[model samples]
Target: MSVRDPNPLDSRHPKRVAIVLSSPAISTTTGWPVGFWWSELTHPWLAFRERGYEVVLYSPAGGRCEADSLSDPRDPSRYSDTDLISLGFLSTPKLAALVEATRPVSELSVDGFDAIVVAGGQAPMFTFEKATELQRLFVAFFEAGKVAAALCHGVALLRYARLSSGEALVKGRTVTGFANIEEDFADQAVWEMGALTRGTHLMPWRIEDEMRALGANYVQAGLWRDFAVRDGNLITGQQNFSGAATARLVIEALGG
Candidate 1:
């Protein structure tokens, strides 16, 4: 899916950005379906498109991408009503169609895009945590000096992603991701729904723990607040709230 610049006479080639999302996956702990977060994708998408960048959506396992129900503003739980940006994006049928179907990352050439932004959700904990291909793609973007970013659980990929130098991508770099306190709150919310009564942790490990173990200079804002960090071309956001901030940083890195 592509978004053309509003100006018809503009002949210059627009910047290209790729947004990688997770394919639908069932949460082992909750026994509920999970996928990409709505705000995490939509907010950054808006930021990129408004700057006249052509964005494409891709998935590790291509095809239709589902949004985590809790992140849907229309969900009965009303947990994300304040996500007006996603709501607005979802309201546009043509624009929303871009996420409904996605190409596989394997089909996308790294050199075709200037940057890549990995979207976050519960599924990333399961799908992206060990995705070697995604790890390679992200590392390529970083090594090429392009803007490479991952937010929230999407940052889980960095735990095992290695650079050509055989070091973890986040090693010795400042980064942020879903925090332990944030995970605690999420687990509490899930437990309230009886998903934890079956004796399973929402995620195998917290992103903060994994990054810190890899010697990353991990940082975070207060629980649930917007926070993002940029260490050279590597950009990361603390949680869903930081999506736009992360996208803006990418734009800055691209000199947009």
Candidate 2:
């Protein structure tokens, strides 16, 4: 992807976007960085900004956030290379500015945004498991008929989200997220390091399984490839690598 100019371009009509953060910080168990997965946040932010959308970053519990080091291009884990659009955004002052001033979920008004993106990392499972505020934000976005998306563990929120009629928002809608195999690979790495990797943080139950239980149309592309699925206004990307693809899908769904 080509790096674009960062001139102060404004949206024709500000299309507000609310991105939810997972604040649990990674575990020493996996030796991953202590924070959000880079691409899941950065890639989509870049895509939205490039298209002239106003992006807002927020955490479940507001504070300074961190990005996974392994997801950073500068990490030693580059041995297993990833084409991270995030790295590109991270280097830009305009994009980094958003991350610098992210607000808390409590401060976000769901109706003010055109769409909501739930970002993931190893931390989400721990942080978002029973987070009612985060769940409410997602539910509000879906209820308002705005584009709602989640990548990787962020998809876990969909498991708890319901419609106004008390039905699963994802019921009968196709969705995808980090698969069991990918989780296995991550957990194995931590085990090899002789660290205690928590099964809950890894692939406890595949998104497909829970989606099946919710009567969602669940699909998984080949592992670690850039893939995303759009089911009505709910767009879901499988993993970190799928962030950019998912963001474009959001723009397309929003009629950008």
Q: Model 1 residue 217 lDDT?
A: 99
lDDT (C-alpha) at residue 164 in model 2: 81
Expressed as tens digits, the lDDT of each residue in 1-256 for candidate 2 is 9787544445567678888877756453444446678878878887887888888889887877777667777678793245456667767787777766678899989768889999987677656766888888798888788888999878988888988899998898899988777877767776676655445244445566787899988888887888899988899999988988999899888877
Q: Per-candidate RMSD vs. true structure?
A: 4.7, 4.9
Q: Which residue runs does candidate 2 get wrong by more than 4 Å?
A: 1-10, 26-34, 79-84, 193-205
Task: Please report the TM-score between candidate 1 and the true structure.
Answer: 0.93
User: What's model 1's overall lDDT?
Assistant: 0.89
1-256, model 1: which lDDT tens digit per residue? 9997444323288889999999899987677888999999999999988888899999998888999998999889999988899999899999789887899998877899999999999999888765778888999999999889999988988887899999888889999999999988888877788867644678878899989999999999989998899999999999999998899898888877
Off by over 4 Å in 1: 1-11
